[model samples]
Target: MDTLQILSEQGVLGSTPTVRLQGEALDLSSYARTEDAEHLRSLYSDMFLVRRFDQESTALQRQGQLALWVPLTGQEGAQIGSGRALERQDYAFPTYREHGVAFTRGVEPAELLRLFRGVTNGGWDPRKSNFHLYTLVLAAQCLHAVGYAMGLQRDQLADPSLPPAASIAYFGDGASSEGDVHESMVFAASFKAPVVFFCQNNQWAISVPATVQTSVPLAQRAEGYGFPGIRVDGNDVIAVEAVTRWALEHARSGKGPVLIEAYTYRMSAHTTADDPTKYRLSRDELEWKARDPLLRLETYLRSAGLADDAFFEGLDTRARAAATELRESVRSMQSADLEDRFAAVYAEPHPLVQEELAFFREYEAGFIDDGQHS
Candidate 1:
């Protein structure tokens, strides 16, 4: 199992990154080097902006402006590259930490914060963006993605005019161990569903290291499912984008599902409530920091002269302004009325739920009338 790596730069700054292709990754090399420096620059810009947005979100949680936050500091390469691989018709189902992917899908920074701010159950419309809501329930989105992909298959067969599309399910190494993931894969393989299981193997599942979860490379598991599995350098954004494009193409062509293991690391605490100090070593953090996705891509850009100090400076300015705007949106978010909550409990209003809402409203009125607001 040779890991596919393209921009593994141990070379000094300002030197062009050597493309390292291993295994059967030769086909992906051309895609990685599009000769369009501006494309690479755009990838860097997205990484920079998303990282800034992620940092601001963490700060919001610290300042008590958000109820909680899932930080995607280190996995920007995997998220952004795979996200951009999607065609306009392709749909994506994401786990909770896919804020980087959301940015690629045109989800606003303020929209991404609304859920953590406790102002909304869904941050954005899945139909509008074709990017589903972040599934907080671990690997559950795997099943949903497969079902949706099967539906897409049927939809295309029924109407040849519809564009052929695939679905990509984003989960983590930890979620791979869940039975729900296995079950989803079973159905996908049996039906040859047009789906790509994009696993961002971020080393640890909360406090538990990935070593405790699986003995083999997570990509190897796809072999049992009778599909191609490729492990790519998740920190190398170019490699990730190339590999994901291939996987999406394979699935859409009716070659069955493909599992892509994006071998990356999580630089931040799993969430705002997590404390990495309790379980991980400072040395590990330093080592992964050296392989930081944004830094690696930034080196490639500088070496290629694709961007300059002025461009980066401008991006920083824009990111700061965007964060400020997101903060204001969070602050201005008002809690939803309790009546709306009851209405959402069912597709149609239930008698019992209606009675509960009425009783609660009447009980609240007692405090206001008696001048005993609490």
Candidate 2:
């Protein structure tokens, strides 16, 4: 299906939309709420800041300050748009690379590094932001999100006055192949859970291409589960937000879950430990770069005269400052006590935990005479 995109290649909204859903000319154009120049500007600012944050975090990993880093260099639009689309009561289950979503959920940039720095058990408190800690276990969060959505149903039934809420599961094309996604969809469809399955099809899952995951578009899978599905131009931030807002509304309004495939690209390595140059062609990267999410938004904003040079300049300065502050924060961070780390491994203390803590203590004791590992 043609991806739903409000903006054309040059960042101008198309006069006619050719996108389709269920074999119908999909005109979700009215879903876009970016007509207000200020809202569009805010979206641009979020993407710009997220891009800078991603760059700075990658640099930290390269410099040995972080144990590892997941790059989100090319997914600013998909993340920020959908993230901003979430209501305050909604919850998000994210993968490790969702720094852009974390930013939208009010997660401090430096706090995200605490885990990679090995300084804390987790980066941030999920309850504070309603954005869960990054899940590294593939599509496991998809199931968690569905369960949480079901709980939302129970909560509403109990209180009847509580604010309506939904859940969103952010996974990738690679994780879409996991059985967890299938099970989650089954349960969500069966229970009419309020959740949105958001797949950021960056095309590669580590070294594997998305083609290996599915022959058809990932969004189309929602049909078998008995819900609506749509493929949106993940590079178009406005379009993403619009689609996500509609999905969230559908989910919480007693309808079944929706599946959203954000068709975008990953401009960097899968992680600091990955080397995309080994698998992808440079020319392909160049072509996608032209469809850069930030560039299109900037183009639209400028052409419409929504923002001036001073506004962009201010954003640039803020981006640099944010990066600088994050670097300082990471450099100053200290690891938590080894005991604390072991304690957080499980909800309850176990013999294995004790054995591991004991081993660590013995190892540290061996280094008592010398400031080096035994």
Candidate 3:
């Protein structure tokens, strides 16, 4: 099968929606095949809380608390879904804006906020949660993922008694245009590395729509590079989790890499700095809002009789509390000192860095506060 590649009458891949590209009707409940309603309800609660965390972080940025904020308001489904699918052994390499996944992986929201607040490059230890530091260089982390998977292959070869592990690289539709992502795919497939290339096709790369990126579906691009690929309704958390779980298992079980193109929409601006209204159509916005992931999940929960008014109200209450806690945590993050700017660069200080540090210290000493003596 050609797998669900849609093209415009004018020769575009997204001219019309395919069965695999349907908005919110993917029926993940069918695929999961479990009746643990409470667990699913908990998933809904976590998703809601993460969305609130995302909003609060954005507000923090606007309030001069954070230097920059990469909003993931519309990407909660893909992030939380895939995040929920991973095993503790699996490692995640994420680009910036993966706040939901970080939350799912047990990263403290305040710690992640530090990166945006300019207090530190990253506040948490990636090894602690198998969640790698956020890579800000577009698609650079794709290469890191492939390299880590290669190491996994090597370690397994070196120790025949070891179990398998998978590594996942999270990137946006825009990062797909980077050479590093493609190169990472090439290497992952050639070596049969245990890696899952999770591409969130949120329809726009900054201001550029996927239409300008490629002619075929993003997921199917894996086939050409020697791996199986699947497209899922990214807004449907069930579908994303199920598909991602299967892909990760396949890779860990020696089936090599899998490319998952999550057909989602970026409902908000690309970042707090960019204006989506300048690049996107109002109709597109309306369409995506109708297909909102959180709302769709809410619908399914209600229709499935797993949720009610009180449940939603309670969730809202919990979300508010969580957001308040996160805000407070951000407020408590310690400001970095001038010396810290030079630390962590090397195990031991280098000559030039030492010189720069000395110069900076002298510069600071020159600016004495009115009556203070140093």
The candidate scoring highest on lDDT is 2
For candidate 3, write residues 212-298 as lDDT tens digits: 888777876887898877777677676678778878888999989988888788788788999989988999788778777788778
- For 20-91, candidate 1 gives per-residue lDDT tens digits of 323343456545655778888899899999999999999999999999999999999999999888998999
TM-score of 1: 0.92
TM-score of 2: 0.94
Name every residue pair that clashes in candidate 1: none
Where model 3 places Cα greater than 4 Å from the true spot, the runs are 1-34, 371-374
RMSD of each: 3.7, 3.1, 4.2
Cα distance off (Å), candidate 1, residue 96: 0.7
Which residue ranges in model 2 land beyond 4 Å of their true spot?
A: 1-19, 370-374
Residue pairs clashing in model 2 are: none
Task: Quote the positional error of residue 172 for candidate 2 in Å.
Answer: 0.5
> What does candidate 2's lDDT look like per residue over 1-374, in tens digits?
12256333232345443444544556666777756778889999999999998889989998999999999988999999999999999999998989999999999999999999988767799999999998989999999999999999999999999988999999999999999999999999999999999999998999999988998888889899899888778898888888898899999999989998888899999999999999999998998898899998898888888999999999999999888999999999988889888988899999989998999999789877666565
Clash count, one per candidate: 0, 0, 2
Off by over 4 Å in 1: 1-26, 355-372
